[model samples]
Target: MTEQLEKLNRLPLRDDLRGLTPYGAPQLDVPILLNVNENTHGLPQEVQDAITASVQRAVSGLNRYPDREFTELRTRLAGYLGHGLGIENIWAGNGSNEVLQQILQAFGGPGRTAMSFPPTYSMYPLLASGTGTRYVTGDRAADFTLSAESAAEQVRAAAPNIVFLCTPNNPTGTALGLDVVEAVYEAGTASDAIVIVDEAYAEFSHAGTPSALELLPGRERLIVSRTMSKAFALAGARLGYLAAAPEVTDALRLVRLPYHLSAVTQATANAALAHADALLANVEDIKVQRDRIVAELTELGLQPAASDANFVFFGGVEDPKRIWQGLLEAGVLIRDVGIPGHLRVTAGTEAETTAFLTRLRELLGA
Candidate 1:
C-alpha cells in the first residue's frame, strides 16, 4: 500500500487534491447493517415492479443520449415536492452528492469560499475542496447543536460565497429549526451568498418538523436538496434533486455536463416518484425503529441526541471502540463516526433493529 501510494503521488495531481482521501464508509458483509443510514426496509414489491418496467422502456433508447434537460423527471420531482414548484424550479443529478457538487461548481471556485457547521454532514468540506472552493468551518455548541442566532452570526463573520446547512445533520441526527435557515439567509445577503438546505433525510424527519422547501417561495438564493436514496428506497438508483428558483437551474446548466442524467436514471426516479406513497410507508416504519432506538438508549442511561432522521447518535459509552467491535463480531455493523465515546446507527427493519439493540445491550452489560 505504501509503495502504491508513493507511486500515486508521483503523478502530476492537482495541488489541492494531493493528499486528500475520498469519502466512504465501511461496506462489511454483516447480518445487520445499521451504518450509513440507508433505508434498510428494502423497496416494496410494487415500487420495484414500477422501476423495472420504467427502465425496461428506457432501455430501447440507450443508443441515444438521454434528454439533457431531463424534463419529465424534473416535472415529476417538482410535483412530488409540491411547494408551487414547476419543472423550471427543479434540477437533478446522479445523487444529492452530485447535486451538491454541481452547486459548488457553479457558485464556488478559486478565491471563493463555502462554509458549513461541523458535526454535520462530512461531505460539505469535501465538495468544497473538489470544486476548488475554500472550505470554512463554523462552530457549533459543545453539544453539537447550532442555534439560529449562532448560525446567523457565523455567516456574517465568514461572508462566504456559499453555505451548506444540513438538517437532521449526519453523524449526529439532529434537525435544525427553519429559523436557522431564515437567519442564515438574512446574514448571507451581505455577500449575496447562495444558501443550501441539504434535506437528504427530510422525508424521515419527525412529524411537524417543517422542511426548508416551505421557505422556497421567495428565497431565490436558497436551495433545498432532496434525494430518492433514503425514503424512496432508491439508493442504488442514485437520483437526487433540488428545488430552487428557475434561474438557479439555469445557472447549474452552465456547469453541468451535457446529458449528465442518463435516460435510465430519469426513468427510475420518475417511477419511484410515481409510487411515493408506497415507498413512504416504509419511512413511517423506520421512524418507529428510530424513536425506539432513542428511547431504549435513553433507558440504558446513554446520551442519544434528539433524532429527526432515520438514525440515532448517542454518547455515554465508556468504550465505543469495544462496543463497536463486539457488535461487529456478532455480525452487526454501525458507524463509529470518528467521535470518541459515540456511535451512529441507522433504523432498519424491526428484526434488524432488534438484532442491533440486542447485541448492543449485551456489549454494554445493560
Candidate 2:
C-alpha cells in the first residue's frame, strides 16, 4: 500500500491538488458515535415503511433516466420550506456539497475568489479548489463568533465573488446572527458577491431563532443551503437542497449535470417528507442532550462554545489528540477538529450522552 501510494504521487497531478489531503473525519466503530453530528435516533417506523414502499415503486424505473428537472422533488422540498418559495427557487444535488460546487461553477472560477470565516466547514475550501476558485478565509473572534462589523470589514477587504457563512458552524457549534448576514450582504453589494448561508443544522438551533429563509424576500444574491442529512437522519439518502431567488436556481440549472437526482433518490426523499412530523419527533430530545453536554463540560472547567447546532465544541485541553485517544480506548468516538485545545461531539441518544460524559469525566479524573 505504501509503495503504490508513493508511485501514484509521482504521476502527473494538478498543481493545486498535488499536496492537498482529502477531507475526512475519523470513522471508527465504537460503543457510542458522537463524532459526525448525526442523529442517533432514527426514523419513526411509519416513515421507514413509507420510504421503503416509495423506493420499491421507483425500482421499476431503473431502466429509464430519472427526471431531468427533478420537478416533483423540488416542489415537495419547496413546500416543506414554506417561505413563499416555488419550484424555481429550489435546487437539490447528491448532497449540499455538490449543490455548493454547482454554485461555484456558476459564479466562481480562476479569476474569482470564495471567502469564508473559519474555523467553519472544512469543505468550503476544498469545494473552491475543486472548482478552480481561489479560496480565502477571514478570522473570527477568540470565542469563534463573527460580529456584523467584523464580517462587513472582511467582506470589504476580500471583495470575493463568493462568500460562505456556515451558521451553526461546523467544528465550532456557534451560529451567526442575522445581523452578520445582513452586514455582509450590504458590504459585499459593491463587490457583486453571492452570499451563501449554510444552514445544514438549522433545525437543531434553539427555538425562536429565525432562519435565513426569513431573510430571502428581497435579497437576490442571498442563498440558504440546507440538508435532510443532519436532523432528518437521512445522511444515507444524500439529499441536500438550497433556497434562493428563481433566477439563482435558474443559473444553477445551466451548470448541474442533466438528471443528477435519480428516481430512487427522489422517491425516498419525497416519502420521508410526507412523514416529516414523525421523523422529526426526536429533535426536542436531542436538544436536551446537547444542552446537557454543554453544562456538564463547563462544570468540568472546560469552556464550551455556546452552540446552536447538534454538537458542542469545547476547549481547555492541554493535548487534544491525547484526550481523543483516551476516549477512543474507552470505546467512544468524537472529533478532534485540529483546533489547539478543542474537540467536537455530536448529540446522540440520552444513554449515549451519559456514556460519553461518564468516559470523559473518568479520563479527566473529574
Candidate 3:
C-alpha cells in the first residue's frame, strides 16, 4: 500500500490536493449500523411500491436524454417546501454535495473564499478546494454553539465570498437560530457573500424547530439545501435539492452540466415525495431513539450536546477511540468525528439503539 501510494504520489496531481486524504466514514458492516447518521428505518412498503412503479414508468423514457431543466422535479420540491415557491426557485442534483459544488463553482473560485464553522461538515472545505476557492474556518463555542455576534464577527473578518451555515450541524448536532443566519447575512453584505444554509437534517429536527426557509422571503443571497437521504429514508436514491431565489438557480445553470440529474434519479425522488408522509413516519421514532441515547449517555456521566438532528454528539471521554473500538467489537459502529474527546452516533432503530447504549454502558463500567 505504501509503494502504491508512493507511485501514485509521483504522478502530477493538483497542488492543493497533493497531501490531502479523502473524506471517509468507515462503512463497516455490523449488526447495529449507526455511524453515518443515516435513517436506520427501512422504507415503508407503500413508498417502496411507489418507487418501483415510478422507475418502471421512467424506464421507457431512457431512449431520450433526461430533461435538462428537470422542471417537474423542481416544482414538486417547491410544493413540498410550501412557501409559494415555484420551479424557478428550486434546483436538484445527484446529492446535496453536488448542489453545494455547483454553488461554489458559480459564486466562489480563484481569489474568492468560502467560509464555515469548524467541527461541522468536513466536506465544505473539500468542496471549496475542488472549485479553486480558498477555504476559511471559524471556531464554535466550547459547547459547540455559535452566537450571532461571534458568527457576524467572523463574517466581517473573513469577508468570504461564500459562507456556509450547517444547521443541526454535523458532528455537533446543534441547530443554529435564524438570528445567527440573519446576522451573518447582514455582515456578508459588505463582501457580497452568498450564504448557504445546509438543512440536510431538517426533517429529523425536533418539532417546532424553525427552518432557514422562513428567512428566505426577502433574502436573495440565502440558499437552503435539503435531502431525501436522511429523514425520507432514501439514502440509496441519492437525491438532494435546494430552495433559493430564481436568480440563484439561474446562476447555477451556467456551471451545471446539462441533464445532470438522470431519469432514474428523478423518478426515484419523485416517487419518494409522493409518499413523503409515509417515508417520514419513522422520524418521530428516530427522535425517540436520539433522545434515549442522549439521556442514557448522560446518565453514564457523558456530556451530550442538545441535538435537533437524528444523532447525538457527546464528550467527557477518557479515550474515545477505545470506546469506539469496544463498540465495534460488540458488533456496533459509531463515529469518531476527529474532535478531541468527542464521538457521534446516529439514532438507529430501537433495537440498534438499545444494543449501542447497552454495549457502551458495559464498556464504561469495564
Pairs that collide, model 2: none
lDDT of 2 by residue, 272-345 (tens): 88888877778888989999999999999898988899999999987788889988988889999888999999
Q: What is the TM-score of each candidate against the true structure?
A: 0.98, 0.97, 0.98
Give me the overall lDDT of model 2. Answer: 0.91
lDDT of model 3 at residue 22?
82
The segments of candidate 1 whose C-alpha lies over 4 angstroms from its true place after superposition are none
Query: Which runs in model 2 stand beyond 4 Å of their true positions?
Result: none
| Deviation from native of the Cα of residue 305 in model 2, angstroms | 1.1
lDDT of 3 by residue, 22-65 (tens): 88889888788889989899898888899899999999999999
lDDT by residue (309-356, candidate 1, tens digit) is 999999999999899999999999999998888999999899998999
